[model samples]
Target: MDHLAFDDFPDGLIVAGPDGRVTYVNERVRKLARAEGDEMIGMPLAEAMPFDDLNGHTWMECVRPYDGLNTRSAILEQSWYSPRGSEYLITASLKRDRPGGRVQQVVIGIRSARVRNRHDRERSDLVATVAHELRSPLTGIKGFTSTLLTKWDRFTDEQRQFMLETVDAEADRLTRLIIDLLDAARIDSGRLTLKRGPVRLDELTERVLRSISAAGSEPSWRMDIGAVQTVWGDEDRLVQVFTNLAENAMRHGHGLRRVEVVEAEREGVHGVRVRMCDRGPGIPPEARQRVFSRFWRSGPGAGSGLGMYIVGGIVTQHGGLVDIDDAAGGGAQIDVWLPVNEPEALRDGDDRGSVIGSGTTRG
Candidate 1:
């Protein structure tokens, strides 16, 4: 059957004859079985590929392919354990000569379960993180509002203000989380378009510092704005980027000390760079690779864990990059670089399309 065609398939493929004996099998099948030469050919299909179900029944015993109802045409993909106890996913297509007829051939496909298992783990992580963040603020807001509604006159003016402020802060946090989720969705779907423009790095950093000060930040903070030129990017999105980076520093950086905005010229690319340095225990070397990944966090906090991932997407969209390193003295440093070269055609408010496609919008 010119078995070479099936041998090139990535997943394991095996064909069983009408009598249920192995007619053909791929290299992947042989490799999985650890078979040598043509040893796998002509063997009983069940013995050649001994995958067992949760009940410890082999495929033949579980499915009873030749003995099943004549209407059955396929076996759905599912997880099973091989003879060596490694997990795998297997599926089958039963080729019949006619409806209600006996199965003429059984074509089986199998692959390792690692990729699906990893994706499932990541999805579970996202769900858990989102649920935790959502519950915290919602609980606070609900408790405070219910209390104020039932006992407004019993609380002093200062107490009332404190309660209201807490609610407001929680609301803002919820808003930020929602926006971050939307931004992440847009980035993932390649629909995150930038309204191109020239953004003043100095002015932007000043605005961020002002916002931080208004938030009642401590005096431990300092800034040094260098003679950097205006960068070509989206002003509002860049603000979101800087805000997330600065907030991440404050939240996880333990003792965030300073932010330095300076002109950077690297590899003939003239642009501006912002460094957020802290005095807290720095991130470990191994954990740095996961910094820009979605829903990643070092410890517990109010963050949605989507901040760094969004920041990375925005910076990448701007023809820039984001990296983490040890701070000047200690702690962790997050450096962001945005190139100054703007396409002559793209201007402020111009839809520059998504970063993935550059000039193409999603259909």
Candidate 2:
């Protein structure tokens, strides 16, 4: 409604009159098309900023914006090449004063292809990671089952139990991988739901510690909890959040040392902050932001690298945040903030908690 609103828009925009001449554009369009001020004005829209596909068809020639079907009201976004060879995505809206009437104006939107390109690369990475992660477990499960069936009588009871246990563990690995993938999909689609209730942060960490230690030898760990308050979150998801963090500590931690949960205020929101500190090599300042990305790993490590990604997603879903920092003395310290109050949208029974930012999820 306001032309000025488009002044600072992230993407470029252009408007054309019924005659197909450039009538208006935002500041973004000038830099996007490399045009000087008012230079693009009055020229035919296509002539002013020509873009073409691989087949050499100009955008105007392909869309035939002024000559298309009267009922056609818009053009779907598609890839195009600028005259300078940079990639761009273009879409346009066709407006008519009356139903089935002649087109009055064409409003076009364009943005650099870098963002979409990055997303495509990330999706490709996800596919490759999922395929590789799935193959190892599937191979183990298949081999174990095949051997058991082919040599049913040759193995002793203890050997049989070990083989079966291996298969079981592989199956569990597969299940966890699938669940992580599902959670990732939900987060990306903004469909992640949180069943919120009061949750004790201190008890949650203790439970996570027990689970991790039960899996193997206990690491050198000490937990100090201050006067922390209960947080509003899904107990199961919160458990997942902490479990992932604690497990990370045990893996790369060389050995976990100090664990702390304390009450604090950030941006006026009172919440509980849980820090899982480890004695291993701490994350570098430059890499701190990347640890939470999908499939990110410190090095060649076990487990699907989706743990921290899912951690951030779940925390964001609960209107909280997560962060990685240098720990006391040495090693890494991961901080998770959980707000003590129910997210406004959660209180209204809507699952969209992305409106919440910093200090209760991850800063």
Candidate 3:
């Protein structure tokens, strides 16, 4: 944990004394430069590291101290390319001793830019998805509302009722989409909290199914309420989990006909297993593992792509298991297993981490 232990740091680190002589180079830096550790210790930093920007500016300029003490200076980012075209981002900073005192030391940190660049692309993809998803519901609501308001007397009672109903449905969709976005942010920032207690899974399923039915999701549904017992969890969160899965089934089941939920015993595990199966095109074998990924979509549709991911997070927080399978009638089957005796929530020292984790496919 000391300064010298930078050797174990993931980022490359190097230190130069007041005279700009190389005082230390951690193992990470030595490995990155493909040079001996001791060989880099005594030489001038310029001769030892010799890092540079692609624009031809030497890293020596980047590490140079400004005209103040205790006022650290830094180079935000400098790009370097290896002989084989590998890229790195080197950030150098100067540490000062006291007000107007000499520069105490210069430190350089290095990290690969490949991962950062990939994340940038993923962020752009998320932005595009959000835009398209939000636009769909907004467009429907606007069109229907404007027509009804401007031409109220022109339509028959049935037609007006249909228009009003469509508007209401679109509004509801917009509200849910916004809530999903908020949930995603909360989950990512580790701010999601759960109120835990004993919850009846059978009753919760019936309530969620009633809501789905009221939404007019066109799918026949059945539930086998076994002699399952209560599980300790956040009742609202559990409701959200099944609601999400059921909605997902209604959406992806292009040919979706029947959706079923069953509570049954799982061998070798002291818990109840609830399976939600749909009769649709069925998730592709290879894609089953990735359906819970955030902002991931298997096809074109109006969805924020955060439902399944949120479902996974809530279940994980409750110390439960979730998996996918091929349903009996050739569709996706999602299984959730919750222990009758709920396990303690996970924590990190004093901070209680969020119940949800990253929805991104990669974690």
Candidate 4:
């Protein structure tokens, strides 16, 4: 095999001689260990990439070559904890030149378990959160439909219509929840596709506000459109951002006085800004920074915790930024800063951007 190819391998690689002396290491090993030069080449395997067993003995001693005649090869997976508190999945394979021959070398492959474990936990938490979120709407639809079907003759027209409306609303909620899961998957895979175009921020805000009104949500919304209303972005995505923010305001704002959206420009900033402010219980100081994190919830009845994350992702895709702060009068304020002009790179899809998934995960 070409040795140079190993340098490009996705995982770290280390080749040790039969006597357990480091002979070669790929670029990944150098990067993972933050090593330089030939410092790691002549060192013992454990010395270069240290690992201690439960008994405090070197990992090398625990997996040392077996003496029996039939013991020809061995493979094991172990967790390697770095001095810097990083974790790696270490897969070590000891191979003999031929069956029953002397153990020639041990090939070790290392990958960052920290990133993998984090993603796994997030996925697991998402599945659980989705299941919990789906139960309420599904139960509502089923219970109402069952009751209506059994008591068709006993119900008044008004009662029947009310139940049917409830079912419809619950169904819509389920659809939104499912769409969010799909979008999350797409975002994770980095396959989020955006249809870039010129979007009017003020018009989009009005449309979303009208949507909230039509939904029968009782919240006063105030809009302020500044000089620059149009931006280069995906129209549908921009609409989604507005919709989520409006809904979030309705759900979280207590004694909800009103939702105010303002689009303006700052003196030194290069982009147009949109601020969504509500006169309700504002976010706490510490929780402000984590509102946009996936599966993060600061309080009960907070939607699936995916709303702000999705909002963050979409704004970032447009090369914009979203931040949370206290509204002027004791409420939560979310500020979205978007560039008036789209960068040539973003328009051409040449820049790497994160995908924004929608749906609520409020508890």
Q: TM-scores of the models, in the given order?
A: 0.78, 0.75, 0.74, 0.66
lDDT of 2 at 212: 80
In model 2, what is the error at residue 136, expressed in angstroms? 2.6
Model 3's alpha-carbon lDDT is 0.73
Best by TM-score: 1
Candidate 1 local Cα displacement, residue 102, angstroms: 8.3
lDDT of each: 0.82, 0.84, 0.73, 0.74
Summed backbone clashes in each candidate are 0, 8, 1, 9
Local lDDT at 155 for model 3:
99
Q: Write model 3 residue lDDT over 226-341, tens digit each, in one string.
A: 55556778999999998888878777864233333333455665565677777777878798768778887768663677898888888887778888878886887888988766
Error of 1 at 209 (Å): 1.1
Question: Between 2 and 4, whose lDDT is larger?
Answer: 2
Total backbone collisions, model 2: 8
lDDT of 1: 0.82
For candidate 1, the TM-score is 0.78
Q: List, residue by residue over 30-95, the lDDT tens digit for candidate 1.
A: 888888888877898878768888677888788788786888898999899987788999999998
Q: Which candidate ranks first by lDDT, i.e. highest? A: 2
Least lDDT summed over 10 consecutive residues: which range in candidate 1? 354-363
For model 3, give the RMSD to the true fold. Answer: 8.5
